[model samples]
Target: MSTKFNTFILTALASSSSFGLTPAASALPPVTAISGYSFTRSGMDLNYVAIEFDAAVLPFEVQAFVSKLGGCLAVPENGTDNFNAAISLVLIDTGAPEDNAAWLGIVHTPAGDGELHWSTIEGDSVYFLAFDKGGSSNSPEAPLGVALDAHSQQWFDVTLDDGSSNIRRAVLSFPASMLDCDADMIPDALVLALGLGEDQDGDGRLDWCAPAGDFNGDGIIGAADLSIMLANWGLGGETDLDADGTTGASDLAMLLAGWQQ
Candidate 1:
């Protein structure tokens, strides 16, 4: 929603709920270095998780209502009521503000303490989810209990947990459908698609994707891959290894880093 970081921090201190330090139900899956992507924006270098996969690859929360099928939400912990009502999970798609989807961590507001609350981000609007237990009384005045299936949580700790930032991170479970940020049939689980190409269609699958540096798709990153990276130097097509629209020193560094991988 809004990038009001300063106001958010102040409100969080005075808000009804604070689940930032709540322990996760379980440990999360480990993310290998090559399994995710990292980029810098607004002076922040976020190394978040992104990949493509099948519906069965990871366990997902299911519900009769399509809205709750495969998404993520944060709630209160046992005996504690205070929770962060708004958590914006930002997805970096196409490296553009409009293209990225906000999904986690980024909070806009806190409803209150101990009360379970949720939010949904459509095109550009933010709405809270309200339930009425199959009746016609679903409204903010009469909120219903939301079903949250926690397959696992608290899988990893933030190396950034130095108290400078008042937030912690965990790999929460979600329906594989959420991974399909573009709403395409293909799940964007291309863990190795880092800097592979534009992925112009934003269809969750990579374009001209090979192993991180496997240009020729020979299943290995070797001399052939190096040749390809150099051949297309200063270009912006398939060999744009960094996906920043250019193939140059950084791209060469990327290719060389993966030599014989």
Candidate 2:
């Protein structure tokens, strides 16, 4: 697919289809210090849930649960035609486990209000799902009508409410394609934290998913890669993977090890 730049904002919503603020046409601010849950990238078709936190967002967390057996797309709220899309779910951790909930807010885009969207990073269409457990209440099934065998101890369906208002828990069904950025048969999330999808080259594209081992960042590990490494040899710089203050045989070995066979 051709490269196109898409802008997104970080907010306090847990649904990818939800963005609470205006979309900025710039690279997202860097993400530093994420805590709480483990981020794992997988190569097989399996079921797992990842709970992530961003220190920059303060008390907001994202929980991504994947079930290879089956998944669904996120649904729009009642009477609202706008589809809110987000790269990651923004949630509020209520200190108390029983009241914990994730919320999906409205999305703003250049094309008007729409769901949070991004080019398929992994090259597959991902099914999404959202449902209200009804504010402080628990439900065995989601209201959006998708059947999920929510057996993992890490997940629970809970709702947030203030007697008059209520919000629900959400889950996303992204295909294996969405997570694998390098096509090296590994999900990028497995190697780095979230926000690695930000645009870096100013080429109207995101370098977050750039393939690994392409030291020169030209999208390939070829002669240019070797040349670049050799040039940087004895000088600690881009080729210094070991970071021992110099690029030498050890760095060359590492570079060769990553050579695209």
Write down the lDDT of every candidate, Cα atoms only: 0.32, 0.32
After superposition of all CA atoms, the RMSD between model 1 and the true structure is 17.5
Model 2 compared with the native: what TM-score?
A: 0.27
Off by over 4 Å in 1: 1-124, 127-136, 142-211, 219-223, 234-245
The digit string of per-residue lDDT tens for model 1 on 1-261 reads 112111111111111111122222222222211122222333432222322111111111111111232323322231111111111222212233222211232122234454323332111222433222443222333222222211111111112222232222222222222233222222244221222224664433355444566767787899888888788888865556555667889878877776787
Give the TM-score of each candidate: 0.29, 0.27
> 1-261, model 2: which lDDT tens digit per residue?
111112223354232222232122221123321111112223323112222323212111222212121222222222111121221222222334322332222111122333333211222332333333342223222221121212211212222111222223332333333333333322344223333344454322236544434666777677878887887778955566554667899867866766773
Candidate 2 lDDT at 57 equals 20
Please name the candidate that would achieve the greatest TM-score relative to the true structure: 1
